[model samples]
Target: MGPLQIKNILQTSPENQSVTVKGWVRTKRESKNAIFIALNDGSTIHNIQAVAEPGQFSAELLSTVTTGSCLKITGQLVESQGSGQAVEVKIDDILVYGTADPESFPLQPKKHSLEFLREIAHLRPRTNTFSAILRIRHALAFAVHQYFNDGGFFYLHTPVITASDAEGAGEMFRVTTLDLNKLPRTEEGAINFKEDFFGREANLTVSGQLEGELGAMALSKIYTFGPTFRAENSNTTRHLAEFWMIEPEMAFFELEDNMNLAEDFVKKVITYALIHCKDDLNFLQNRLAEEDKNKPQNERSIPLLEKLSFVVDNPFERLTYTEAIEILLKSKPHKEKKFQYPVGWGIDLSSEHERYLVEKHFKKPVILTNYPKEIKSFYMKLDEDGKTVRAMDVLFPGIGEIIGGSQREEDYDKLLGRVKEVGIDPENLWWYLETRKFGTAPHSGFGLGFERLVLFVTGMSNIRDVIPFPRYPKSAEF
Candidate 1:
């Protein structure tokens, strides 16, 4: 009949007040006289302990209410019998609307493997770890919008389907309406895939950075937050077939300005999640620390709030890609790994190299700039060396490369030349080059791997765990 949140109840002014609460049973304990149930409502991180006497509600009635069963209860909020909690509910009435059987259901008291949990993605949120992850995910999302919005950046909705692959990763999943059995044939003998959809070979966008750049050119500042697809075959936890990206584009900005945006943006995200998701973070803290009560404090102090302050207050260490390579060559951590690529001045830094730079060398998030032209995308502005591009990847302590962005090749001839050099048809990027043709103002931006950011904020290791309904390789169900 009434709505009450466990958090609100716990903070009630009148301690012994009566309240009505509705939620699903998380865990239940049976006794000869009374039955205890921990009820979890999605509104809060905490669950209310409900004590219902078997004497009043028949044993059969109590039996019907199992873990995962939905219920509404009218109860007096009294102090808890256990030392762990301050208050609990003394149930006066109970309504068991829905029930779940322990035998047939998925969740149980025992710990389930991450692989097993991935199978039941939909129901994973009810678990503590997933709940914390999703909470941090949402908090970080809001933080991203707030960070951009506070700075007067316009929120732009970029197209999900585009004829152009923004990242030029060749990882796009094509969008086609043409029937496979009945293919359209042009004068050429090749299959006319261009006949599909909007009369061209369109596919899911790999990044919205290109479109975001256009918005920035007009609005000065703009950002896009949405799903982007990558059909890359690598099946690592760091790679996802479908993922979200936050790309903030700015006009009248160059490489240094772009790095400042990224540094501030990363801090804002961490700051917001730490502030807004305190309860959820603390949940992780307690869960992780409880495993080893004697564990060192430094290793366990990973919740966003405790560590984010230091990161936000400090300026990110900036090192050129060449400098980073030099440091990696001379670094002790790299000595142990015997890096697969083996460090070289002109070589692209591997994830391992980036980790050594951020995690061991700097011991914080770092920006490595001016990568070799050969390894970077075509859109990056050319550097003075005439060999390297203006591309940069923001490497965080735990998550190596969280962002990839660069100043656009604003020179009309340079862009066209780069397009030709990259062997992509210049026609596909005609409109992109048009921005440069029509008074472009040295715009720059970067794409933060939203899942990786979420992972960083929540101290979650796997990218798959951060995204709900994760679309990893051979994984589309649950």
Candidate 2:
């Protein structure tokens, strides 16, 4: 057998059975005549023990091996008496597969800051913290697919290189296939972008909502999970140049139906990760205990179980955007910090406002709905109130807005007028108008930032750490 997963070993109750396992050394402890190596494969967060007899393998030889060195050990399964683990192996054979020179390798048996770890992103997965993060990330991704698949949602793949800027924010990273040095120019000094591929300026998609709306008109229910790009140049913990987004669009659904779906979707994902990723979360717990001796005994290192059960079983706190603003402004907690941007009746909610509402005021995930027309997207339906558009933003405790959704404009005239009101040309959205013209239904959808969800699930502090290869402002370091 290849490298055996640590979880599978507990199932292997056959004591004294000889087995070969291959993994990297996490920690190695040596006595006068014996050595114990904690080995871990990518399979599980739990580390396995390999007890080496110094009579067979010298203590000097074992001590020479550094942390993160890959090795294969042939040993007999034995019950461990050590404080750290349950089952251990008495190693009869030890073979070094890959050697780690301790002098140059930055990773050692010590805690490194998150900043230092970012510099060594290539090898950070071998660390316990990152290993758990990656495992949670993988589990959450699987949960997202499973939730959609089990719910009878059609998985739709949309085009990446889109001719239209769906958000109309002009935040697209332009896609070009021409030599700029020998470029076509208009009568003016500016280059003619119309001569580019697709006969017009095309760029990467920022959101799959527009295309998803088209699919929903036909498919009735459709979901798209794909990579999106934003060239906003925002340097923040939550911002990324490129990130994943999951958009679910449903036809014949109102704003209430959309809010229900968003709530269920979030709950389902958290539940799935809790069930599937318990071991990884436990590993993180132990790491936390080791890192902070003063960690609360009652405070759960992994709140996945308790947190998710509450989510699935309970109802999300739903409040109108106006209600949330009132809570933020009236709260006794807001007395200390004066908000930089004036909190008014129509301005967009800042991250501070969002966090305060969800974390302090509600103490649960809050769905802030019916935002002002000036702050929301053009495609969102104008509410009966006239002042507000049908927009909903789901705010979690740690992250402000994980999801943004709205009921789309089914009326062609209204949509065209809204686009024009938003200072965008309706003529440019030629094919998009066809959906409203043909067969239109009351459709609703939401866009959840995939990296943000991953960060929330993995308990990762920075967006860069959640993604394998992060792209941010002025940086795409491999």
- Per-candidate TM equals 0.94, 0.92
Cand. 2 Cα-lDDT? 0.83
Look at candidate 1 and tell me the lDDT of residue 232: 88
| Candidate 2: tens digits of C-alpha lDDT, residues 146-205 | 898888889999989887788888988988977778999889877788788777788999
True lDDT of residue 412, candidate 2:
91
- lDDT top scorer: 2
Alpha carbon lDDT of each predicted model = 0.82, 0.83
Which pairs in model 1 have colliding backbones?
Answer: none
